[model samples]
Target: MSQHQILSTEPKPFVKWAGGKRQLIQTIDRHIPVQFGTYFEPFLGGGAVLLHLLGKNPEMKCRVSDLNSDLVLSYVTIRDRVEELITSLQTHAKNYHKNPDSYYYGVRESEPKSQIEKVSRLLFLNRTCFNGLYRVNSKGKFNVPLGRYSNPNIVNEENLLSVSRVLQSKKIQIICRDFAAVLSDAKKGDFVYFDPPYQPVSKTASFTSYTNKDFTYEDLANLVDVSEKLSDKDCKVLHSNSNSKEVRDLFSKEWKIVEVAANRSINSDSTKRTGQKELLIKNY
Candidate 1:
């Protein structure tokens, strides 16, 4: 499809990522720099902000990365092998419908070897899994149980197509790497958005296991250092994190911190999902 056609379809995040910015896009939109050079997103979660920016400027150059190799592969597969990935998803959907209970667990336990199958399995599990979460155990195994959905949209072909086309742009480069690596490439005038796994507000609220490795306090410290360097280089840096004392303490007074209301939809307790506040820190 043409680039204009792809942009018109409004390509969105293909997976339901934890800490996804879809809900906070309106507030985030207000904070984005009006003009910038290359875009950098080291902690690309659901990529809501990336897609939002791309939709507004399809030609925008973006460099996005994540530590999760499987998630990164999904983006590449959708961009290069979307048709095959869709076909594989159709098969998964067929079998999942036949016996959700058995098939869901079976796929969860069974890891596929092929790239397309791997991406398909991840998408299938994300769609039918509890709260659409992408959590992994200490051993890097997906452990989220099946969610109760009478009818889940397993095969969102149109959105996938849109996502695929938008990703096909040569200006967009997806990589699997540590978040701090952005320091190597980010330059002055670039816009860098950091949506890292948030510092938990409480002991029970911690859910940073997007991979087998939990995002530690040490990682948060590294993020602070990186943000500081990026700020020194004059790069437009915007960050999101839970409104916690630890997070607030790390960022200095120079960074503009805005407290925005957010919903914690991934929380098991529905009552606690609302009335959450998140910090949006930016250096203009």
Candidate 2:
């Protein structure tokens, strides 16, 4: 309706993502290096920083990747098939509004045959499911319960359209790859951002079921090694993770770690969700 509203909503992250960087964009933005060659984001969750950077610099070339195939498929679908996605989402919205509770579970358990249907299922479940979390069981199934929303925005037409336009507007390369593997192509002057699953604060607080696979402590160490290597190669790196002792020690030897406050909003217990300390490590 207005330019301000359009800018506020345009080309935003289409799907809800766990540990998404939307709220931390500005804090991270101030630390983003002045100039760089290509932009590479390995842990492209909802791509808040990626989308924001691209929107501000429309010509910025980018390569984004994630380990989750379904998540990556959703991105590819929205980027290449926004029209079809909108149609499918509209259909889902129509059916969901008719009978939300029953319809939510039905869609949750559904096994779609086509890419469009698969992505539609994912987006539909994400919008309606608990807290927009992307957790799955050991069998790789979507298991988050229905969110407590009287009216979930199942089909944000304008946002989806804007996402498509932004994807089409740039030379953004989307791929499904292991986060560390994606950085092998990184060269000097390339800015790389890592938003890997945050290391858990405690044993009971772990929630890294993004796929059937788990991102364990070893995985965090492996990522630390990757960051060190990237730093050695003179590639600018920015990473975010829980502000735990293990994470700090891993990078303290050779990186800049900044404390960032982020809201832990996805927890079922409202009391547990509050401003938590997180660390954003960088190698400049």
Candidate 3:
């Protein structure tokens, strides 16, 4: 690919995210050759990969899905009402930053359900939450505490509008469903990228609880099955996971596994947040 290809494309996400692949995008892109048909991404967390691909490969026909309803709603709402969301986000930025403690927990207490409230609460918490980590308890509440940042850019109108343009493009389809459902519609020559919850590298490291539901070993095995089936049909597939023996062994024969560095987001100590190695498996 040309050096100038991705230069003009808009930049990556502004929001801090757990397991976000912004740092790994260039490496991932280098590994993935430019030639491909359509693009598919299941388990789309912050969608760093999809958005990066969209910017780099404008010709891509894309389909992306995620299990989180709130995430899906946020994306859809932004796609449809980006201008309105931006307006509301400006208001949120103004009000929440002024009285963060009250606004943070107030929205948490209000149990707001309407579109306005839901989007506002979602954006508010996302901006203020510690490291932008979206975690919830078994009761399904927004439980992440307020972060340390004094002034965060809560409203980014240009990026929101660009995302809306991408979503509005006829070539893309955004779905809210089980990640496995993505495999059903994927055809030959399609490219699939799975950035699922990283299987813990160590016993102490395993915190896959993005939701109440656990992404167990069984789920990993299921994903391996999906990858193999897709590979058999000549689909190009790539997955990112922790560099653990168990994760490595799961795709032992069928995948081309490579190790690369990744930032550890869950650790409490800022010093421990340095780059650590992770696994990248591709079906070539």
Candidate 4:
């Protein structure tokens, strides 16, 4: 297929993730630089921003990474072995429909060693888990309970195909690595976006267990330091974090910090889900 035809579908994120930027795309887009070199996203959760940017700039070189190995593997599988992955998901969907509770827990408990099965398991759990939230226990296990969706779209074949096409580009590179690794490859004029798990505003709001290790205050501090170093290298940096005084204090006065209104859909209390603010830290 022609490049234009491939990019026309505009694939959305296949998995629902905590702190996904899908709802905040409009606000995030406003802060993006007019032009840049390779695009780097170290915290590619749901990849709402990366996919959105790719849809607009089809040929833009992108280097995205995530600490979650399974999540990173899913991107590679969808890009390379999409048909096989789809078939696996179809089987999962069929079995899940037979008995949602039993199948979900069974799949969650079984640690499939193969790549295809591992990614398939991750996708199945994410789709069926409570609120589509990806959380792990201290022992690094998928612990979220089954969600209450009457009918969930487990096999998103179309979106997966579109994602595969977009990701097949030679310019797009996905890897599993730490966020700080970008400092070695990112040069001047490149755009680096950091959407790390937001620091909790209160004790009750802490939910940064994307992996076994929670994104602690020290990680946030290190992230701030990394952003500062990226700025020194002349790269354009944009960051997303909760609107908290601690976050504001960590980022120095040199960074342009703007508070944008955002909704918190992960909150169990529907009343607490709306009217929240997030900070958009940038260095032009």
Candidate 5:
């Protein structure tokens, strides 16, 4: 089918993600072109946008990557063995609901014997973890405590099958590496979307690190440099970050940066948590 025709299909994901961009789908769709060579997402967190795009434009080629190996492994597992992963998740849910603390930390503490087992444990922990947050210590362990939710959806079988179908059609590339490295393969006419760790707008609001490693100032600058080079080569770029002054200053030259409001989730106080502005840098 033609690209325009394919885009008419409704897109949806089967997972509940903490920082998922379901609300921003329309906003992103408005900025993105109707046609592009390939869609590249370097920081593939929940993959809400990627799944949406795949469903909307099944004919479009796409690539997704993440710095977190476990996250990548889960996605790859879902793509390759959706049934197996779903079964494992169902088994976990059955046992977890019985003994919340024990099962929660059991998956957290148990060492996976294989890749699928690793993926299963990761997904189980992610669903039951506090606030659906993906955080790890320096020792590379799942540390998020069990949440209050009694019955979290563990097996998103339909969505997993959809993702797998999308993978089968196009030359979809999945990588687990630094975001900068993905730019090496980017060429003119390619579309790249970056959603990095939020450079905290305030010191107190910083949380949700996927690993002990923090995204440094150098990483942000390197991203800007790569985006600039991509723009020079006529590759469309869009990046989402906190609307901090430092971030604005860095991309002010090349990007058409706009401040858009979003909620701050790093804090525990519900009353203090409200809408705050964030920057969306684009070179279209």
Candidate 6:
């Protein structure tokens, strides 16, 4: 298919990410370098921005990574073995539609042996689980209870197909590594976008439980140092984090910081979810 055709039917994020940039796409797009070298996204959560870039320039060179190995495996499976995945998801959707309650928790407890089964289980849990929030217990097992949706979209074939196509056609590198480690190959002229787990908005407002591990203040400091080094090497850097005094203090005056309103997906109270401020920092 032509790039224009794909662009017309652009593939969006398949998962409901906690810190997803779907709502902030236009705002972040405005800051992307008009023309640049390879693209690097160390914290590739949900990959909303990466999809936007692929839509704009199908041949764009990109390297995307995440700390979540299961998430990375899902991305690779979708890209390389989407047909098999679709078949697997179809079975999940049918069974889920038949018995939402029993099937949901059963699969949650049951472990799958194959890669396809594992990816399918994760995707199914993501779609049907509470708020689509990916959280793990201290034992590193998914523990979110099943959501109360009457009809969850367990088989999102369209978005999955489009995402698979984009991954197959584009010059993209998908890896399972630490953010800083995957960033080692970054060179001058490359544009690195960081969208790590946001700095906590309040004492108990952290959403970093995507993995068993948490992104502490020390990691944030390390990320800031990495971003600065990348900037010094002449790489265009753009990052997104919670709008907080500590986050603001992490970056120097050389980087431009812009505040934008984003809705918090995890909030139960609808009124409390809106108008939450997030910071977008860039070194142009």
Candidate 3 per-residue lDDT, tens place, 165-259, comes to 66676788888888788678888888888888888877887777776787899999899888888888889988889888888888858679988
Model 1: residues with Cα > 4 Å off, grouped in runs: 1-7
- How would you encode candidate 6's per-residue C-alpha lDDT over 1-284 as one tens digit per residue? 56555446788988877788998899899889888899999988799999999978889999999988988999999999998998999999998888998999999998999999999999999999988877888899999999999788888887888899889965889998888874578888999999999888888787788888899999999999989889888889999999999999999999999998887767767877888989999998
| Cα lDDT tens digits for candidate 1, 22-50 | 99999999999999999999988789999
Clash count for candidate 4 is 0
Q: What's the ranking of the predictions by TM-score, best on top?
A: 1, 4, 6, 2, 3, 5
| lDDT tens digits, residue span 59-78, model 4 | 99999999998899999999
Residue pairs clashing, model 5? none
Better of 2 and 5 by TM-score: 2
Q: Answer with 3 or 6, whichever has the higher TM-score.
A: 6
Candidate 3: regions farther than 4 A off: 1-11
The lDDT of model 3 is 0.78
**Per-residue lDDT value at 235 in model 5:** 90
Models sorted by lDDT, best on top:
4, 1, 6, 2, 3, 5
Query: Which regions of candidate 4 are displaced past 4 Å?
Result: 1-7
Report the Cα lDDT for candidate 5: 0.76
Residue 96 Cα positional deviation in candidate 3, in Å, after optimal superposition: 1.6
Provide the RMSD of all predictions against the true structure, rounded to 1 decimal: 1.6, 2.0, 3.8, 1.8, 3.9, 2.0
TM-score against truth, every candidate: 0.97, 0.95, 0.92, 0.96, 0.90, 0.96
Per-residue lDDT tens digits of candidate 2, residues 158-268?
Answer: 888777777875578998999888557899999999889888888888877787888988998999888888888899998889989988888765688889888877677
Model 2 gets an lDDT of 0.86
Residue 13 lDDT in model 3?
60
* CA lDDT scores, all candidates in order: 0.92, 0.86, 0.78, 0.92, 0.76, 0.88
